[model samples]
Target: MIVTRFAPSPNGPLHLGHAYAAVVAHDLAYERGGAFRLRIEDIDGARSRPEFVEEFFQDLEWLGLSWDGEAAFQSHRLARYAGAGERLKAMGLLYPCRCTRAEIAAAATEIGPDGPIYPGTCRHRAVAPEGAAWRLDVTAAMNRTGPLEWLDEGAGPQAATPQIFGDVVLLRKDLPASYHLAATLDDAADGITLVTRGMDLFRSSHVHRLLQALLDLPVPVWHHHGLLVEPDGRKLAKRRGSPSLADRRRAGEGGLAIADALRAQRFPAGISLSQALNGTP
Candidate 1:
């Protein structure tokens, strides 16, 4: 059966961008007679809030996005991430890295898609496992997997280039697993067939495809859709104080009405889905 997921972190309120993403994933599965799953990415214990999680469910319910089966939470899947990380370690692809962000920024020279890439200084260090950040050796893994590729439903066939993100983190000191590790593992666990997400994460798909190969997991087709943006051409983000779905709800907006408006490509004043968007995924 085809499956898709709308995974969100419960660190803040769901904004218009989030609503668009949820609608896309939910509609893709529901319209195709597939399954739509909702997963909570709450690995960051320090930042994740219980109230936010409650609000997330409320917002999704208000948006008319019904998910299949029970919801999955990253906190409940730490052992799975740990097991995968250990397997990568056994393969000699996972290594301990104690480099702080500042230290890495100082050492890094080239800028990749996600800020300055790690300088790989800790790759040779004999760092301990406990309370240490673990990184994946993308180059070493690529050498093992040879040339790899995956399909993007929107962009068609493409080669997987994991080199853009050098030595990506698998596990952080404060968390059992990083976003990369948790997401890759849980998708396989839930049997998600189509990874529906925004195009901003297109580069992330390259790293994820490589992780799938190195971990011996099933690869899924990705649909990297366009992003919703504000009138200023800026992407809606929680950190930027974008209006939350809850805020609109408090103002007495109807859920289905908003969903209909979005379907028509209409957004709140001065906001719109990126003009680069084509047909629905």
Candidate 2:
């Protein structure tokens, strides 16, 4: 059985880009007689709001999409993430890092998908400081797992080269798990067979594939679809103050009509699609 999921963070409103992502995931599952699930990625305790989660439900409902069973919440799975981190630590693949963002920016020589690749300032520390972030030793991990590959429905086979990220964070100082650890674990836990998300996360999949290997989690095929962007080529994002689905609903626009238009690639004026795989907006 094919299992797909649309995991959305409840830190902001659902915009057209999110709607498109949901439509793709939902249709890929239902059209193929598979199960489509929804997961609330509310791990950001400071930003995640119950009202936003409620709005997510309302927006997806308005989009005429439904998921199988009750939604999963990342906030409820902190222990699982912590355990995964501990396992990696026990295997000597994780190290506590006390470097701040400013320190990394100052020392970083190469940039990666997520921004400045960590400089490994604390990778050789004899003792970890209090409340330090945990980073994966990507080099050591690759040595253990050797070469790996993952399939993408849109792009076909891809050689997993997670080294580009350079020892990504598995656990943050403020959170039990980073996005990489939490999302990868959640996908495996939910039995997601196909991961359908925007192309901006295409490279993130490389890191995710590595995590899957390290954690002994099931690997899922990925489909990184094109992103919905503005006239200036900027992808619709909550931080950019993009229009939300709620605004459209309040304007009395038909939800099904909006979804149908999106399915047909009939984007609103000034909104276009970008298929760039560089993770740029």
Pick the lDDT winner: 2
For TM-score, the strongest prediction is 2
Clashing pairs in 2: none
Tell me the TM-score of model 2: 0.97
lDDT of 1 by residue, 1-281 (tens): 78999999988899988988888899888889999999999888778987888888888899888999999988898889889888888898878887788988998998777788998987876657557788888889999999999998878988988798888998888888877778888999999999998877778888888889888899999988778887777788999999899999889999888887777778888887773432221
Quote model 1's TM-score: 0.94
For model 2, residues 1-281, the per-residue Cα lDDT tens digits are 99999999988899999999999999999999999999999989689888988888889999899999999999899889989988998999999898888989999999988789998888887688899889999999999999999999878899999998999988999877888899999999999999998988998899999999988899999988999998888889899999999999889999999999999999989999899846632
Q: What is candidate 2's local distance difference test score?
A: 0.91
Q: Which runs in model 1 stand beyond 4 Å of their true positions?
A: 275-281
- Residue 56 CA displacement from its true place in model 2, Å: 1.2
